[model samples]
Target chain A: MLDANKTIQLSHGGGGKEMDQLIKSLFFKAFDNPILRAEEDAAKLQLSGPVAFTTDSFTVSPLFFAGGNIGKLAIAGTVNDLAMMGAQPEYLSCSFIIEEGFSIAELKIIVESMAEELQQSGARIVCGDTKVVPRGCADGLFINTTGIGRIIMPNISTQNLSTDDVIIVSRDIGRHGAAILMAREGLELESDLTSDCASLWPMVEQLIAANIPIHAMRDATRGGLAAVLNEWAKASNVGINLIEKAIPIADEVKGLCELFGFEAHDLANEGTFVIALPREAADGAVEILQRYGHCEKACIIGNVVETHLGKVVLTTPWGSHRYLDLPQGELLPRIC
Target chain B: MLDANKTIQLSHGGGGKEMDQLIKSLFFKAFDNPILRAEEDAAKLQLSGPVAFTTDSFTVSPLFFAGGNIGKLAIAGTVNDLAMMGAQPEYLSCSFIIEEGFSIAELKIIVESMAEELQQSGARIVCGDTKVVPRGCADGLFINTTGIGRIIMPNISTQNLSTDDVIIVSRDIGRHGAAILMAREGLELESDLTSDCASLWPMVEQLIAANIPIHAMRDATRGGLAAVLNEWAKASNVGINLIEKAIPIADEVKGLCELFGFEAHDLANEGTFVIALPREAADGAVEILQRYGHCEKACIIGNVVETHLGKVVLTTPWGSHRYLDLPQGELLPRIC
Candidate 1:
């Protein structure tokens, strides 16, 4: 059994009795399931047809934040990637690189958070690996989650976007970026500006259930909205014209962006996503998204156009237009 | 484009122009394939029937060893896990957590090594994620590879072992651990000892082609040969009697183990594996394995029995017997 006060040691990752005890007492107990309990080198799965596979490594600083920790982010990040491709999140493999001397209690909290987040998408941690480095060899902890799911709605790709497609914002953007910034700077914002970090699979599943013909879907993470829009435009060989005023931005995020001389559009969002679909289905998708409390502000934000191919053009509230190029510099490191 | 002289910066992982350029020029060029070039959040694969999913995080110290580097180990480690399950290594998802200020030139070498190793199994790097942390947040780099392969031989479980089953080792043990120790300790033993780091898929494919009924197969990795034997004994609820002299150990590895006061059986191996099969099929399996130069020393070293259930009993050259318990305490840190 792991002692709460005892920091992790090299022996715990030595592939011996100590490692076995730690895995069984901590990880296995937290992410328990028959597939994982099978204890095979690999988890046996009955996957068929087209499968969506994705991977993400979370090296977020200040492992824990106001609304979520690296554990929650790791799970949601990979699950959301599969969901964006219209895949039903099913099984995930989690790998952890831990720093020696890290607190056992803290690791427990992170593991529990991951278990809690997996519930939102009904995904299971079917397999995993753990490695512990000497103290200072790594920061507190980093997690990598690789996920595979069955693609229920096939052919959803960035290149599928068309000229007349409508772009929808699932929720307010920039909260995750701002929240992490605040935590790192130790700012007393005196506001409930937690990260927009939550599982988006439930809403995605509902959209699929409603038969929305999604052309392109992506979660706006690092480099945020600007990066996603620019990538989509270039990939689809179409231009995206966005109304700057129409995009949702929470007040706290806006203030933080202004104070830091940062653009809200380039700030990351963990739970928010952008969708491209036929204009006719845009309202229906928004309706389903708004049904979730967190996505109550979901609305139309832009439209795809033939002009300015391979570019994202933003129409400002002042009736001016400018190119929103892909982010070009370091905005913030380890923001998620 | 990445300049060999320039070190990796935070901007290179900021999900922006710099990050995109780095990926396209380095990772994309090395692991080029249609599936990877798809540029979606996840890779879409046509996987069918029963599949095996496994993951590993490589934090091997002294990144470069006598026989291979971390990149080779990362790919081979994950692929071998799938191969051990009688699955053909197919698709792999790679994720990297890098430390800022690390040399781009070094990273290029590692990436190229991964691409080269993938050729042995024909497994494509379909999808990946990259994150760079500020200096000192990590040692140098850590790579996580999650792999999936279709199971060609099912029911190959540790629990499948029965009384009188033959146990065979693919090659000499402890080379990997000794090589790493030499690299870290800066020792010059004037020996041709190198880590047994290699892709086992080619040899495994031949065994499968030869119709070897493997009851259980596992690569002796972190916990080494001792760990595998003990785990098998416990999992199968059967006893294993091993002939001490029959277990292969290279002279250099034995010297290093003796000098360091370590057990060769408890040291790690990147390429070595142990297989349990019916007594009648042992020779065929060994014959098939020996065809591969790396596994030329493949031979039976033990047998399953009803006595001493759930334990591994080692018979020494002098007719002495001792229980080979699971390795205890830290043998070596970051030995892959």
Candidate 2:
């Protein structure tokens, strides 16, 4: 048993007795699985065919926030990457870099949160490493999760978008970046303006099951919807005409953006995603997406066009158009 | 092209135009491959059969070290984990969490170092993520590498040791820890004492190719030789009798251990590993390992025994015997 009065020490990450105890008592117990319990340096996975491998490091400040903590975000972020690639989220590797004196109870809560989030996608954290730095050597804690999944659908790519494709927004965007900003500023907004940080595997899985010919699907993470759209436009060498009025944005998020002098399109999102597929499948994809609780505001926001190659043209409600270029400056650090 | 005069900004990790430029101009160029060039959310890999999955986060202080930098360490560490499981090093995902204002030149050097090290195992970095935190939120930069490999020799586990198995040390112990200590303490020992931080995939591949029936193999990383032997003992429920005289220790490492009041077996070894196999294969395995320049010090160090189950006993040169316990407390932080 770990002492309540004691905090994380350098010894806990030294790969010896203390590390063994910490791993067995906390990580092993929380992520109890046959593969992980095998206790080898690496996890032996029985994977076959094509697999999607992705990695992300989460250094979100204020480990706990409005909707989810870093642990939940870590699992969802990497799993979502795999899911967006039309793969079934299967296995994850969680690594932690902790600062000395970090609270054990908080660590436990964060770890439990990871286990809870893994249920959404059935992704097991099979292998992990923990390293503890001395005080002030790092922030509270940083987590890196790498995921590998079996690709159920192949060739869903950023470069696959064509002029016949219609772009759809999975949900209202910018909540994740707004929520992190609010948390950092210690804002007490009376509205339920939580970060839209949830596992996106469920919605992606549904889209795959429905046999939607998804051309490209990406979560609008750090640079938000604008980044994904711009990258898609450039990669596919097609023009994207986004209907600004049709894009979903929560009132609270808009208000925060107004106050912060930022654009909702440029804000980060954890759960929100953008999909490009043929116009015929657009309505069906939106219909399936809106069935999910978090994706109620899903709608068709844009369509691919032949003109303005490699550019995203946004038409405002006032009928004026502007190039929705890739975001340039930093909107919010550590949003994920 | 990235401006040579500018340092890394938060926008470099913001998933915006700046971030994409940084990744393409630096990471993509250094780790160039068709899969990586595709720039999908996740890398699509065609893998079959049983595979090994592993992850490691490198937060080693002094990014530049005696023998290698953090980039080399990150690649080698994760690759070695897969190799230890008798897996052929294949694909890797590298994620970087950088502090704002980190030197671009340093980053380039580190990345090139990673590319250089990848040649040892022929593993390609297939997918990655980059995040930049605000200044002071982290050290200069922390790298997390997750690897996937196909299993060549399955069921090589820490729990597979038997009384008939003999243990062999790959090389001299404690060089990594001693090197780090020397660098940190600014000790110019009039001796060429560099870290043993080379990739072990070549040696591991040779061992597998030679048809060595390796029961278990593990790198003496964070907790070093003592930790590996103790873990093998407990995991297999077999006693290990170690010949202290036969365990190779460099003179400089011995001097450092004496000066720091530490045991050589308790210090970290980045490139050294221990192998447990049947006594009949011990000489063959050692010969194969010694063919490599770094593994010149390879020798048999111990043998599994029936007495003192789950314990490691050391026989000293003077005929004195003692229990070699698993390391406890903070031996040295960030020795990796």
Candidate 3:
């Protein structure tokens, strides 16, 4: 029997005695549920009607960082995708790729974090798979989470935005990207700046409950605000005009962006999200968003326009207009 | 812009122009479907009632093998899990973790294989995600597939076996584990031994249609027959008595197992499966299984017993009895 207190070994994933022990002691205990305990090859779920399904692989370097680790990110990333589609986050499948000689203690820590994060959205980890590769075959760990949820609000899409729709950002942008850059570069900042990685299902559920006529909702992750705006413009075939000054940015994020020569809008935000809705519902949505602890900075940022179809134009505070092109090149890899 | 002819770069996973181009030109063209074309963060599916959800991560080395590649393995592994639960494989979420600088041509080949494999089970790759890590951060590629299906036969579990139940092997076993070992060791044998890595859903669907009164069904993957039988014994609190001479094993697999000092029962088999059915239905079940191409060698191998609770007793040809224990230690890592 391999001691999980030590490093993980190939036997722990070999589907034998050690593997069974590992799963029973670690996984089953952490993600205990009647369905999982049934020991069927698959988890039996009772879901109906239109359901949302999404998958995300988190290979973030420095597995642990400010605010969250890869495990939390894996859960939040997939759950947020479902929530963004107006789905009530429900069941999730977690798969881990662990390198041999990795610390089992660290694995437990990560798994605990994942279990804790699931409570935020009331989603359960129903099924999971674990694979261990030889050392050097992979980095410490990579997690893949696939989520399934019931669609509470239908027809929310990138192509749904139309003229006169107002855009509102959930919070300040670029924190996640900036935090990762700081961690990789080993920089010490005076401020308490951390990645904005968090589960967004609670807020999304509230929005759905409020009966807001949300046209579309998306979390600005990789390629950041710029990427989301660009994709929306092209998908909906509408021009988006952004008041640059209205977009929220923390001072530390701005400073980091200035130092790295990266646009704040092009930096990812894990927890932050953007919403498009009719102008009549803009204030009510923003008012509802302000109640969340992280959404205090939520405000209107942009709106749909007729000019420059399939384009995004940003007006600077100094009254200069510039086209916000889709982020190009490798700005920051593994920002998630 | 990153050229598809060259190696994959960071931009290819950056959620930018390159990523969009790769998804459109490669993935979209390969797995074309209406649900996937909706372009939402999550795929919308209309699933109702009892659904089977399973997940698997394929980290097999030498991405391509004699019988299948990681792509095919990813699809078949998850699909088989759902099938084992007597479910109709429906939706799959594919997430890839690729090393930067990996060949784009190879990725396309893998993706095409995945698309082709999906046809066997009529499962669609509805939602997916791609992440590229820095070089050396991961092996060539790791695929995580999570599947969702409607359960055609419910309550099939490991704990469902009763005394008059008979055990049956779907076909000859151990080919998959042997083939992988030979490939990794660079062995050249005259015999054409290929992996038995295949989609088992079609045959499983037949069994369900035929109404074999299945108590349990599981693919003998890692830890092979020994693991599955032991799991069944312990879960059901019953004993399993196997006639060693009756279990089928291919010549090449037996040869490889002997040379490696490994037991054929301890070796893995991807396509092969085991079933526990009522004694009266045993011959009918075997007849149905043998009708399939790969299941020509399917036969009755064992039966449930009241003695030796939570154990598997093997009856050799010499009238000798021995315990068939769960595999211990690492037989072969990354054999999936």
Candidate 4:
């Protein structure tokens, strides 16, 4: 058993007895599964058919946040990428690069969060590697999760969007970015603004089951909704006309954005997603999204148009329109 | 075109125009492939039958070494893991967590090295992610690679060893560890002592093609030869009797081991591997290994025995015998 006060040491990643103990007592126990317990160089998996493979490295600073930590984000980020591809999140490979002298107890909490998040998508972490660097060689900890999942609903792609497709927002935007900012600044906003860092596969699975004929679906991470819309516009060679008021944004997130001189649309969100489907299926998809507790704010925010191809045009409440370019400069570093 | 004098900014990983430009100008161009060109959230793959899934994160200090750089090690390490599972190396997912202000020119060189190494195994890097942290938050750069491949030769496992199974080493050991140590300590040995870092899939592929009934095979990496043998002995519940004199070790590595009070067997090797198979197939495996110029020194080093189950016993040159225990403490940090 690891001592509560003990911290991670270089020996823990030395590929020796200490590493063995750390793996068996901590990692193995938390992520116990038949495939992982097989103890092979690589995890043997029985995968067939077409699969979606993706990877993400979580370097979110402040490691811990209001709604999630790096561990939960690591699992959700990669799983969400697979889910956005219309794939059934199945397996994940986790690798950790830890700084020497990190708390073992804190590490346990982070690991347990990963195990808890895996249940959201039924994605098992089958194989993993750990490396510990010298003190100051790294921040607290960084996690990389690569996922592979079977594609259940095919042909959902950015290029599949047509002029008649309707754009929808799953929920409020910018919560994740706001939450991390608040945490870093040690601000007590007196409002319950937590990161929108939840596993999106559950909600996506519902959409697939309803057969809404999804064209393109992407989680609004990193560069957020603006980036995704711009990429989609260019990939599909269609214009996206978004209604500024129709897009959902929490008052708290908007307030934080104002204080920080940032745009809510450009702020990151871990759980929010954008979807494009035919106008006929838009209402059904929105209805399905509304059934979920977290996605209650889901609504149609825009529509695809043939004019101004490869550009995202946004109409303000005052009736003026402008091109929403791909985000420029760094809004926030290490924001998941 | 990226400015050669520019350094990587936080915006390069901010999921914005800068990130897109960096990826397109460097990563996409270097690892050019149709699957990667699609630029979906995940790479779409058509896989069947049992597959191997593995992940490794490389944080080796110095970044550059005598024979290979971190990029080469990152690719070869994960690909080698799949290859050791009797899997044909295929798709790889690379995620880079880079420190802010790192040189763009150096990043290009590293990315090119990764592309060069991929040619050896014919594996394509299909999907990836990039995250940049603030300066002082991380070392220069860290790479995490996750790979998946089809298991062409199945049932190669650690538990498959049995009595009379001959143990064959692919080549001399401890070069990687020694090379890193020399580079770190600024030791200029009179002789050429470069890291034995190379891809092992091509060699593994030949053995599989030759119909060698390989019971088990593992690359002697982090914990080195002693770690691999000890793990095999315990996993297979069989004793291993190694002839110390027969195990090949380069003179420079031996001299360094003596100077540092470290054992050659306990040092790491990037490309070297140990194989366990029936005695009848030992010479055939050695002959095949010797066909490769780098593996010319391949030879049988030991055999499985019933006498010290779950333990490895080494017979010294003068006939003294001792238990070779699993490596303990921190032999060297970040040697990978």
Candidate 5:
């Protein structure tokens, strides 16, 4: 009878034994925290001082496709975002919008993958909400993860921005973009282009431990470096000048961009970030990120400039200049 | 030049001006919070002590149908969950899973409706995330809202079920069921059987303000009152005896149940709740809830029993007894 107990079914959502099995064997096995294992309707936590809060939704298509599926992405995405602000990743609340006909086995696999990600990142999904839609309302599965991180760091930032900041990227641009192109385009490429998706908090903690005045940082997910650079420029009311040759891009991405009439710069990136640090700490920040897996290709891409307000200009390989607009709309949809 | 702006396109998810227009005209107009006004990456809040955190996803079919649409449902669903816990609804994070080829006009309408609900409920959307799927992958749109409320009341319990506790429902059953059935079944019933879906936090706050020992509470959504009752019965390790004849169900729902082979008790409800209160506080709780729009049909449907453990039985109108098992599956598949 126990051997016959199989994967999840629609009936589990019906709130029966199937639901119990899914919760016990699947969710519980993957995530077992005292607060989560309490099996309460909500999680209760005691907070002391200031808190840094963040949330994100992942709707990457082909739920179990190449690189990593939606489940792993959901955990890493929110955790990495919190880490960017140097917040200790603590409790996460998860919600799923599932289409009715999605296979239960696939759901289990995704959950298992997420479990591995959560374990490595030291985060617990304390509460979760699930909703199923008719076949049409949603893609196979869409996940929303809301994270709560305690501000253990004394001085992260309080809207402090200045002109003497150098912009540093944790890693090479377009590895995630190149990998998505290979997977989405169904290519058999010689280059081993895998997504650089991993937690950045460890690297962030290392920098914080080093006592660097990291002004502001953003994970370059959707619009890549262009979107994040332009956003920081507008927020801090400064300009960014990029040395096109100094910026990192894989040869494969450049090739793919040429084939699809797309610019590699505008493609989506998941693992890297655009960080503004003091000009003096540029060397130290670059060295720290280089030691981490996420930033093996780390480099000083550019710097926050005092001159042109709200403008991000890229120096072309030919040594001329052009204004880099925040790619008006999404380039490759749901790359995250 | 103004007329050149025609409608929403795939690029809106790409984070463009049309997306800005949609947010400014629909969302910002309704949710005017300082954090959202700045449109920053995350919402920053300064606070102390414990916080109540909750998240819910809305994946109703056709995005825009009868009674209320996805937008209002998303806002109302999260706000109501927070209210059930005796928390003051404060910050909300909204995430959207939008399908390719969805009508721009429909998306706008849903956002506007959700915004209106937020304003009415006094909750602000502090952050937002958006994702888009390919054309055949999704129906139209799905929304997930994560809610965080400051825990004003110190001690509230999900395991507060005692032998002498009374189970009180906020209002009539199956209003949302009837509305969805009409929309899906294309029935033209000449009745104002609109969904009972409004924010329930305000209704809950009115009751909590009276200083009553609220043992357990839940919004009778997806699986309805029976499921919640079953959960309480198990959590509190007690038996529940509910008289079927005393339960309040609309006449129209009863009629529809007869035709569709659906049980009035099993039908999904959107804007209702079942609260387990101290035996002494039952009368006061009922009186307070009735003063609000949600509990006009409120009643003491059942009482907690000390003898039998983890069981919920109902006395039928015909003097027969049946174990009110937790719902085994979706009653109105994807009704929410």
Candidate 6:
């Protein structure tokens, strides 16, 4: 017996049998392809070379928020994920779950935004799909982007980051987070803070070109410096020692964070990077990044250590210490 | 001064400048990877040897439609595309566009369905992104999946299609299209004619192992025979002469099509395939494909020819003649 649920409910997209039926009877019926035909767990392509792959999802509210909207966020988010692997972003596939009755005009805007962003990142949106649910089934707009990029500098190592590695941030922190907070909470902030949203390739290309002996690089996004530091610690099986005084923060953002009882260290900043490099090449890499106008506010944020596995401590300006942990609850939902 | 209307639009997805802003400000910021960092159009990767890349989109309406949902469709569509290329579908990247108020349960279901289908196809869901739009901004769900596969068959070739190529079908046509018509138009055809929605790789694998001199293969999906034949015709730079009587048709589907004034040939069919092979290997290919439970009814319907430059003509049972052109107007909206 066929039942008609007039509007979409969360259960429909739950990846269950009902969803499977929808695909088998409807979607799979329309477009047929081999990759989809295999029904594999992960698409496995026999590649003759080493490559990089990345994926990201956007659950941000205010489909169009301050700094950057969901459209821009969707493409950049995945592209950057692949880039973090030191892989040159290449082809992208876009998928959309459009809630019924969504304004086509606005979708056009977002699609246009996505197209332009893809161009800047130098990626082609070769293939994609679109589905529509009835009204009240989802938030205004939610987008997911998955990208494939070819690894260019295979020798630029990341699987090995050890002690004596210096952690460098491309610029001052708190811009993106502060912008989001201001926009969401309607708080009056002193600075004209905009998200530092830009392609990192310009800066990364220079670093790779300069032959910097870097261990790893990461974008300081949600959960901010602390989250990124923890990941590095785990990925490289090492420890981190951060110097609070050396970390860069714009005075405007710093003042606002303090007023709001927020920690500056935990703020999210887009288009900024934290790179772990050998002590010897740290200075030179920072210098090279600065020339590209990406890291004008570059600074030595911290250094790696041999002791204290999987732990991070931040020394405060008042000469106090605080244990750093991944942000538990989302401070801002869809900041990126 | 923060003119929100100056905000981004959807045209960005079309590939342009505003799209650049979206990528820079949102996507790259979230996922900072090396390959994505390169930001190149149609990413060029060093040959990993041989590769398979395919893309497909989901624009199904009634997001909770019958048979399979968008999530499962996303996975199956791309997998099938890759398989048609003779590639073992491996990696997949999905992009989602969700509308406001879409139940989280539905999203979860779709994701879960994707996971299940991927497992069935022997692929995995590696990376994905999501975006949300305002209420009434979009349908409940839309998905785009791009799959990459490994070309294990080095000698397998698309260029091998030659004159005297015998055609074989994986299954009967019109089930998918007929089911959709019944569901969409509220037509009651008294029969349990469900869509033939099952992965074809198992059968194709048998065919490949049998070592048939397969020239070309395509999933007869949207535009049905019209779409695939047109594509093959243009690609092979040849004509296809089809025997209308030889094409299999279920009585129920035929009756339903007559009632709706729909051409069975142009109706979308999900679980069917058109394969071309040398005359010598036709029987072998058909025999192997028929070994599968669903494909036991597989039969020969047409052949390839050198003349007629991209034209498909059919010889009816009554010896009448008709030229088949790709359907111009929208035949079925959101059928898949």
Error of 3 at A93 (Å): 0.3
Worst 10 residues of 5 chain A by lDDT: A1-10
Question: lDDT by residue for model 6 over A1-336, one digit each (tens)?
Answer: 113334333233333344455445433433234554444223334455667766555666566655676777777777776677677776665566666556655665677677667766677654444444456555555665667777766544334678898889889887777877777766544456666666676667777778887677778776678777876786677778887888888787787788787876677766778888889998898888778664788978888888777777777789887777766544554565
- Residue B234 in model 4: lDDT: 87
- What level of docking quality does candidate 6 show? incorrect
Ten-residue stretch with the least lDDT total in model 1 chain A:
A184-193
Separate DockQ for every predicted complex: 0.90, 0.82, 0.90, 0.89, 0.53, 0.15
The per-residue C-alpha lDDT of model 6 at residue B249 equals: 85
The DockQ score of candidate 5 comes to 0.53
Which segments of model 4 are wrong by more than 4 Å?
Answer: none
lDDT of 4 by residue, A1-336 (tens): 777599999999988778888999999999999999987889999988999999999999899999999999999999999999999999999999999999999999999999999999999999999999999989999999999999999889989999889999999999999999999998845779999999999989999999889999999998889999998999889999999999999999898888989899889999999999999999999999999999999999999999999999999999999988877788788898
| Better-scoring candidate (DockQ), 2 or 5 | 2
TM-score, one value per model: 0.98, 0.97, 0.98, 0.98, 0.93, 0.74
Screening candidate 4 with a backbone cut-off below 3 angstroms (N, C-alpha, C), the clashing residue pairs are none
B1-336 per-residue lDDT for model 6 (tens digits): 212234333333322234345455544543344544554322333446556676555766555434566777777777777777677776666666655556655665666677667765676544444444455555566667777777655444334556788777777787777777776666544566666655566666677778876778778877787767776776678888899988888888898888988888888876688888888888888788777877888889888888786878888899997888876555665666
Candidate by candidate, in order, the iRMS in Å equals: 0.9, 1.1, 0.8, 0.9, 2.4, 10.9
Interface RMSD in angstroms for candidate 2: 1.1
> Which residue runs does candidate 2 get wrong by more than 4 Å?
A3-6, B3-6
Error (Å) of candidate 3 at residue B43 is: 0.0
Which residue pairs in candidate 5 collide? A14-B329, A136-B139, A329-B14, A330-B14
Please state the CAPRI-style docking class of candidate 3: high
Write the number of the candidate with greater lDDT, choosing between 1 and 5: 1
Query: What is the Å distance of residue B12 in model 3 from its true position?
Result: 1.3
